[model samples]
Target: ANQEPIHVQIRQRKGRWIGHTLRKEPSNVTQQALDWNPQGKRKRGCPKQTWKQSILDKLRTTGLTWEAAKKHANDHKKD
Candidate 1:
């Protein structure tokens, strides 16, 4: 329902999700995925970009620290 281009809309949505996840209570179900670290893994060569890393990268690209981004997301969610 937004007039924004697809890519812009996606970034906003993703940022919002990241923000929402961060704001959840520590014991929330969604928090587990964000905090999870696999017990055992040794892939060959270089490692892949992970979901957590991607979120951090996105925050960087948007010129936001995690806390700031979370606040922004929380504030905008009312709309």
Candidate 2:
């Protein structure tokens, strides 16, 4: 006997197309516990020293004031 094929739908959000079958599966207790890890414990390191120095170097080359360069770095950090 021929079996029926599963039906699936695709969804689009914010100009992104997502396949229906790619949906996240239900989480069990173990997965839930893993997801509940303390957010405060996460630590992200600063960007590479070479990259930061390059930005500073560029700012100096462009004749930007130290304060302006600092502000630029701060704004970039937000991204």
Candidate 3:
């Protein structure tokens, strides 16, 4: 951390996990969550945010693009 804000630390942590999950096989639950749609959806007030959205939101705080994050997922070491 070395004096980084708490939010910064959290975002960095989540971003790494998100990137990793996105690279998993489609059969993986983490990967499926990215595009999973519920059947017979109704009674929605505000649209529910998804795990993918939360991951992207965290990556936004780090200024990383979706493509970049995907590529980063393949990196052997974290940035």
Each candidate's root-mean-square deviation in Å?
A: 3.2, 18.7, 3.6
Q: How far out, in Å, is residue 40 in model 1?
A: 3.1
Q: State the lDDT of candidate 1 residue by residue for 6-57, as single tens digits.
A: 9988988886678778778779988778767656566888576568778889
The Cα error of candidate 1 at residue 69, in Å, is 2.7
lDDT per residue (tens digit) for residues 1-79 in model 3: 3698989788678766776786788799878877886666657696667767776686687798777877877774754
Question: Model 1 compared with the native: what TM-score?
Answer: 0.66
TM-score computed on alpha carbons, candidate 3:
0.59
State the lDDT of candidate 2 residue by residue for 1-79, as single tens digits.
5744433221113102111111223364432432343434334684334423443465576787546643443444222
Q: Rate the local accuracy (lDDT) of all candidates.
A: 0.75, 0.37, 0.74
TM-score of each: 0.66, 0.25, 0.59
Candidate 1 Cα deviation (angstroms), residue 3: 4.2
Q: Best by lDDT, which number? A: 1
Ranking by TM-score: 1, 3, 2
- Model 1: residues with Cα > 4 Å off, grouped in runs: 1-3, 42-46, 71-79
The residue pairs found clashing in candidate 2 are none
Worst 10 residues of 2 by lDDT: 14-23
